[model samples]
Target: MKMKKLKYLSCCFAFGSLLLSPVFAQNPPESQADPQAQSSSSENSHPHGKAYRHKMAREMHEKMQRLMDKQDEELKKLANEMNKAPKDQKLDKVVTLLNTLVNQRIQMHEEMKAMHHKMMGNHKEHHE
Candidate 1:
């Protein structure tokens, strides 16, 4: 039981890391020789400014919310199954559900990463 709990905790930590890694992976700003030029270029780079970025962020948040809702439904179903499972099979059922949740999180992370990449690509193309 303790071993199972440890494994579950580790899986949760790994899932959290996967969810956060992309946010931390963003490229750092490069130093510019001219601050004025840098400021002007940055403004030009994002013509639409904060509003556009906020809109994109809002859309992404909606997408993530939908995905999470679906995951919640799946988890509820899994929990129901676990409750119905026999004592002898409960451990196996838990492990299976945990794997399912982990896989779902991984898929969510990948989708988010892809969406972020596409958004960045579009932003770059717009500037170019």
Candidate 2:
């Protein structure tokens, strides 16, 4: 059972890293010496100004951090409960917690996908 749990966690971590790699891999906008060039590049890349994008990015980062912290706390609590649970109840509790975590991850992924779609739509509109 412990081995199964460890394998499950390992798979989750690998999948999550794969999903988030692109977001982390993005390069920051380069500094352009020419103001006009910089402005044009910014406009072309993102309809919203650089400051607005920065603010949005910061807010999103904070939100993600908060969610992660909450998840961590919940996991810790669940772990404590599982530790104290009777052997007969441990399996059920473990299954429940696994379901909860998987559901949360799925929800988060869906929300991110929707947000990406919305952003892409806006980008298309701006370009058109």
Candidate 3:
């Protein structure tokens, strides 16, 4: 009976995967268009657009740097706190701090990526 149920589940999973494959395989229509044309048109849409892009990039870069610096300071503080804790209590605190650091790192990475996308003009349509 268990073997029969397992086989049925496997068949269902296979069928589900097959049904979803095409949706995953197809690219979005936007990506199919000429990227150069889109970028050029977008850049030309505003007077002084090139300078504007440069200014935006600079601001985002500065913001990213600030975020990274703050995270680093927090991590260092956490490390110091971990060091000061009693040995028996240290393990639990370490785990908590580690999780916090990991989350902050992920957030920093995402922000950096968004900044890069914006700087590249790829995010203007969605961001603006």
Candidate 4:
């Protein structure tokens, strides 16, 4: 009786795998890849229409750059404030600010990884 039950469970599991395998084989889960290909494909496919190539686009790009510069300036100011955040301040608040700073750095690392991949591809294309 135990052998029959074990065999039934094994068959059921095998049947479930067979059903799921087709769906995954057609479209893989994102984890199975590093996702660089998907990002590259999607970026390329975005139309450089009027919105992307027009004067407004240029202005938008410039504005974004300016905003990034402003953010850097603000972060610098925050660093100065952090430097002066002394023993008198609540430790939890100081710790929270420091954690936020570290989190920003982690976000920057992800951006850098993507940028590095993009740059390397460009370099390879240029050489070719």
How many clashes (backbone atoms < 3 Å, residues ≥3 apart in a chain or on different chains) does model 3 have? Answer: 0
Model 2, residue 43: C-alpha shift (Å): 1.4
| Candidate closer to the true structure by TM-score (higher is better), 1 or 4 | 1
Per-model TM values vs. the true structure = 0.60, 0.59, 0.54, 0.35
Measured by TM-score, how close is model 1 to the native structure? 0.60
TM-score of 2: 0.59
lDDT of 2 by residue, 1-128 (tens): 78967765675565446445553354435652343564455365774656664676577668778877887698678767866988667666666666666676776677666766765575455456
The positional error of residue 80 in candidate 2, measured at the CA in angstroms, is 1.4
Q: lDDT value for candidate 1?
A: 0.70
Give the Cα lDDT of each candidate.
Answer: 0.70, 0.63, 0.64, 0.51
Q: Top model by TM-score, which number?
A: 1
User: Is 2 or 3 the stronger prediction by lDDT?
Assistant: 3
Error of 4 at 99 (Å): 1.1
Ranking by TM-score: 1, 2, 3, 4
User: Best to worst by lDDT, what's the order?
Assistant: 1, 3, 2, 4
The total of clashing pairs for model 1 equals 0
Once fitted onto the true fold, the runs of candidate 3 whose alpha carbons sit more than 4 angstroms away are 1-47, 120-128
Residues 1-128, candidate 3: write the lDDT tens digits: 67755665564455445434542253537853564556656567667776766687688878877987897788788778877988556655566666765587569667866865665574465336
Q: Give the distance in Å from residue 48's predicted Cα in candidate 2 to where it truly belongs.
A: 6.2
Q: In model 3, how large is the Cα lDDT of residue 47?
A: 74
